[model samples]
Target: MSQYDHPTNRDPSNKTFEPIEHYGVVGNLETCALVSRRGSVDWFPIPHLESSSAFSRLLDGGGGCFAIQPVDPFESTHRYRERTNVLETTFQTEGGTLRLTDFMAPMTDGESEISERTLFRKLDCLEGNVDLRIVFEPRFDFARTEPTLSATTEGVHATGDETPLCCWTTFAAQPFEIDTAASHATATATLTAGQQEWVGVSYGEAVAPTTETCEQALVETVDYWREWSHSCGNQAECVFGGPWHDLAVRSGLVLKLLTHDETGAIAAAPTTSLPEEIGGVRNWDYRFNWIRDAAFTVQALSNLGHTAEAREYLSWFLDLCRTTTPADLQPLYSLHGESGLAEQTLGHLSGYRDSQPVRIGNEAADQRQLDIYGELLLAVFEATRSGITLAETDWQAICEIVDYVTEIWQEPDSGIWEVRSEPLNFVFSKLMCWVALDRAVDLAEQQGFSAPLDRWRRHREEIRTEILDEGLDPTGSYFVRSFEEDDVLDAATLMIPFVGFLPFDDPRVRATIEAVDDRLTSETGLVYRYDGPDGLPGGEGTFLLCSFWLVDALALTGRVEAAETRLEELIGYVNPVGLLAEEVAESTGQQLGNFPQAFSHIGLINSALHVSRAKGMAVPGTELIGIELGTGATVEAVRDHNHSDT
Candidate 1:
């Protein structure tokens, strides 16, 4: 008789959902998988990041999952490999220790093409004997179609539609038992010290990888990430170096992961319908690329020594601009540059943690977000400042965008928050319209691009004057959210200094900061995007991006110590593997909204740069869209100006 006993079947239907923070992400720059701390691959979308999920146990209990874990009781801990997205989870059982290494095969350098669509999981037993259970259950099309599972020569094959899912393993000790009625496959294995097993799940064709090939793929993936990390700005220019350097690097990696290698389009987040407020109706799809988000992402990455990504994104944006008139531009688009993103609710699968109305395809794409004009133009201005040259065609497209901004700068729009309420003349939108003209004039003068300089200048100054007058409340103490809601403050006003709309020490800017700090800040010091109504049914967690904006605002206003303290506190909210979500629950501190949000990571990088510069560290690319990060003279000048005003 065999010494090892049969492992207990841990049914996928009985598996409880993991906390949002209790997961680490791995990607091949195409699609990503969310691996829970308990050794379950719960959320994975095949073919692409925006595709319908194959395993969505993160949302519904009976959706699907592929879990490899000890049958007996065990505790698990996970962390990403240093400077890479490769996740390593260690399971400690009473009998021995098992290590689970997970990663998608990475693409080669200098190319965005993905040649492999595979997820690899390797298990290594370090000591004593351990019995492990493997469960492979895949529900295609968001669990709407149950796949037919059949045992292949290498492992198990699942076919639901045209796209087949293949699972291959090197566990020759036990063959997988396919349960067609249940739509799952199971296998058990026992290993002693130094024994290792490998599993490969391919989204397309099945290719059984041997032990040698798995080890080689692991080495290549690790090398690819380490090489990419070594190429970051901090490696050469030391763009960020301090106690928080590792977190900054991790943020950069997260941004890179969210970026589409083939198209240079950066998804706001990989997954859709992870609620901002649990069990509320605030969830929306974020898989598409937003102009504002991608522009900010470009600036952050370029500052971090990934200028190639910026150039590619600019190319992608220019191409997108070519397809439509500037007057009809949308706020967001698909990864392949498709503009029509009709929102639809997936009523089949339950939302993450029972958040209802799981949605895909963002409707905000149809909303008129005027801030994108400024953001896109500012990205161009920053790229030009970084020595990236724009083609004549690109210049023409930009001029059209700037001209459109001139025509509509006075109009009320959805604004940056994409509120579904009535359109109001948001102060932030006007500020960005000014930014659009300001950068356009600068670009025209510097690059010798032909543009109506006088007209641009007139609109620019008019915008500045209008904002100074109308953007303020009756008390004239600080900026308001909008002209209609003059009594309400917004955290977006913290960017007044960031975009160089006003000096950091400007009295109005100071008052705005103070007002937001007093009102919009949570008890734990996190900033809410706004306390005003947004036509939504429920409230959301505190915005992580806005909190980082506060950090930047503090650093810019000569409060370096306070900025550092706040930043440290915010860093404490990151998960164990150094990943941040879109928001954090104010009461519970639990991560809320989408996991590994690109905007949150962008905020982390920018705030780190600001804090580094405030501490007298010379960061490269600090002159972002005329927002200066000087330490000595800038701080003293702000202080002197404040003193004189007093």
Candidate 2:
């Protein structure tokens, strides 16, 4: 209920809220939010991930919240309604117990009943004897202002002074009285074993709802989530098919909810500024889409065999690609392509545990992270394999990116680590440069696209040789983040085998794995990025995504059992919803950073797919272990498949 305590204690007020990680994600391809173990929705942004928040309590719990926690200290359990948008949270108290089912289904695909609004339908005890309590507290504009709460024919309403935001609530049964002195309302009711109760919260431009009309809306909403869950279809053919395919597919559906379906733009994660290092200045907005994450995300969908989603994202990305040049492309951008995010903090209600300086926007939008060019190219190339035809202008724009990458491939930039400290020419950035040129040649040869084939091929080989000769250690046993550092382990290195930069059998890859174990791992199995100040001073929970990356690499190397053991350990970190955050703190068994991060989910899906495919297992049934990412395929196979524009 409070912000988390800062790890370093440099800023005692910057508390990082250790959110209990149990959330069932359901979305309608517009946006997704995280609902917790105690049945509190700590993280969710209305309208869009990048837009102003509808619920900001996850970042600053004092901001405001509309939670349905058990008032009797009962046993609470939660889950997603099998393949649907419906969320079920059950509370078992001594006086029998109750179930709270939540969902927000979109009205008839293109319906015009409302311009833009979310109807939160909380259904309880349709046929059970239990008492249920409800709290509807409205805090507008990051909990900066207090709204006036009042009763309505529908149920309840709250309006803020400065923001034109109104929240309307409705209940199915005759509920309890209002608690105006608390600036909120509470209702407790006992239902017969076969009776049902409902509560509805509508935000944004709201109109009065008749009791009959409101009840109908709840029914329609349940139908909406069920329909969305069905869209996942037979796993492997979508984007990331096979093994944990259901998990991957479901996560994709959640991503769809966090995305603007019409715009093809996807948010990094639903929550913002949730802190990387507790109480450290590491919190940044993640609602915006990132160019670097695009390829991985598309790759996940492509791997699932979701051709449409893959192509849709690229189409959306290309729209944002009208940059002055490739180098001008920012690492991340808002869903609508707005640039220059300024950072702001809220001083009210205290932070989650008092992690002070609750940030609203990310200021790292314009940093020169050169690796994005390669990532972007990789994404476009994958779209082609999925059967998407690129327009001439699109192809021209892609080539421009390649051209720009050529000019700055040698410069020292912000590296893949995105270190806030001074810039360095990270090995990951240069490696991606190689990927860009390598894929370009393949694309031109297969698609008959106009390209300087010989020049590109030479450059590709040259980059590879330079990496081997200069970027690696003299012994050729390991690779470093930069030419200046020791053999440091990076979660980014899980990418070595993936990008075809090295074979799973390569000694260098093996050494990197061992080096990672020696440096970044905790005795209890958590992993860290590396041992250094990344532009800020403090500590953080181990990076969960990176740990999963290690799991995939172990599988690739044929260490199946070892990989599985690690996979299970990592899975243990997941809250009840099968969702993972950005990092993990071994000492506390608490999830850190943002909730329901896309990268962590991508790792979970990709590794599951690789291990599942390698071991011949499926995702929803058995957790895959010891599967390698880039094994089995020969160098020739990679080259041929990558070059075959078909």
Candidate 3:
């Protein structure tokens, strides 16, 4: 084997991958894929991001997949084509070098056209004569239907009892070969230097074959990514010449794609029921956006120069805030602010690795996590600042949200990670409550939004002082995850610096970082939310976004190179496809939880912009050191991570 190739190390059964194997991600908001370093497409869900997956090998390789990568599988190298979502992965084989470029045909003008039926994958040979392989595999219903493969002049395809819903692609560059074990067809093509080949793995219900060349699709895709990335301009000095900022802006554009453009509902990620722990019941569907995530989504977008996106999300959020019965303040809500997310399980499909009872809805929608109030208000305050004029009724509804926070800010509840263990007075949730009231009071005074300023201010200060004095660990300089736990530290509280609750350089904030890093950081260098006794069973992958948050924390706290080093290392963790799973198992290198998470991308956006602003460049189109979303917040990095109450 070439020294540059991945070492032929012992293959441990439990560990199927590395934390950094997921190098590229591509999706249409309805579904996404995690491409590995070896040019393999591992995880994908279709019809919708939240729909049952058509390719789910990320959770279990025994599941469905259509892997068309370099043969004699080995580690592949990947990178994004500067400032765009287009991912280029080069497979270095002992025989020759081959490159595969992957990207979704972005919508025109960088604006998502929901209901558009399309997904694109392109292959290019960079240098050296090499053989390119293609696989036409359709494991419909997740390997349930035994598809019969047939090669035709048009292309190779799968026809089975499931019928038309199960579709495959054809290739002219290579001949089709069938694999009896995986029940799939494969193709191999030989290309000389500089030869370019185009392949499409498209699906439609007996639709017309494309007369449109791959060149047309490539042009359209480039137009879409370029236009969307146009909004990435404008930020302060970040970690470097704006790698993080660029990542954040691109990530935001991707996240926006998952939203129902018509209804403003965003999916949490794009895949569902992928477990955080193999054989563990932690698997849940991330197809629908939770209110908490929407708040962050709006916050990240508002600073990225996306006023329209902020307005659209705020419109949905405003409607949610206007919910009557005071019971509407749920820990989780649908993208449209729809409550009552009834939970269900799909028993027909044997779970990935028998991670039984794949779930569809979130039960946490019924949980009364106090943090939602703060997240809701924070989004609204941004809306008001972003040129939104609230009506009198909306303002009154804001007061009610504040009132609810005032009454329950002190109550114990599940923290942001939604630990199902037991309710506690989560410090992060309380701080957000303070943010809600404080922003409300500020808006009423600064933007002329009508509200009861005096009461809101009182509640705000009350929360601030209470957290400062009572939220601390007493023995340590840091705060606990909850008032109930004496030593349970939470990385969620790291946002104290992020939300302007405390400056990044504050000694106490530094102390909290130290505590979290020391306590929650894994041996593999990833961060966890915390290890307090939550109501879950199996352990989870590292909270991928928390690690980025640490990178942001390190940079803002003057550890520039350290922050850069961490950021670089973390970036390496992305799959070969430039997509990230919800979490990463540090030891095994496997990704856990949902695919192409929004929370991870949102954090990436904010952290990148945070780095940019720290270096003093806020103008749109400025040469920022980081990625700048036109919105206010700079994302230090982007990962497809997500969160919820169990």
Measured against the true structure, the TM-scores of the candidates, in listed sequence, are 0.93, 0.87, 0.79
Shift of residue 625 alpha carbon in model 1, Å: 12
**Cα misplacement distance, residue 633 of candidate 1 (Å):** 18
Better of 2 and 3 by TM-score: 2
Candidate 3 local distance difference test against the native: 0.64
RMSD of 3: 6.7
lDDT of 1 by residue, 479-570 (tens): 99998886888899888766656667678988998999999999999999987888888899999999998888887677788999999999
| Tens-digit lDDT string for candidate 3 (1-646) | 1122333311111224433334467655445666655555656555555444555555554455555565453446677665566677777655667777766664333444322344455666666766655655566555556666665555556656543332334344455677766577766777666776655555444432343455565566666666655342345432324655556656766676666665576777766677787778888877787878776776666655567777777777667666664556676666455676788876665565667667777888877787777677667766665668988888888877777778888888777887787788889988888777766776678767666678877888788887877788877578788877788888888777555566555667899988878889988678998878898777888988788788777766766666666776776665543456778887787777776777777766655555544443333122332343322222321110011111
RMSD of each: 4.4, 5.8, 6.7
TM-score ranking, best first: 1, 2, 3
Better of 1 and 2 by lDDT: 1
Candidate 1 residue 221 Cα shift, in angstroms, is 0.8
Best by TM-score: 1
Instruction: State each model's CA lDDT, in order.
Output: 0.82, 0.64, 0.64
Lowest summed lDDT window (length 10), candidate 3:
637-646
TM-score for candidate 3, residues paired by index: 0.79
Q: Whole-model lDDT for model 1 versus the true structure?
A: 0.82
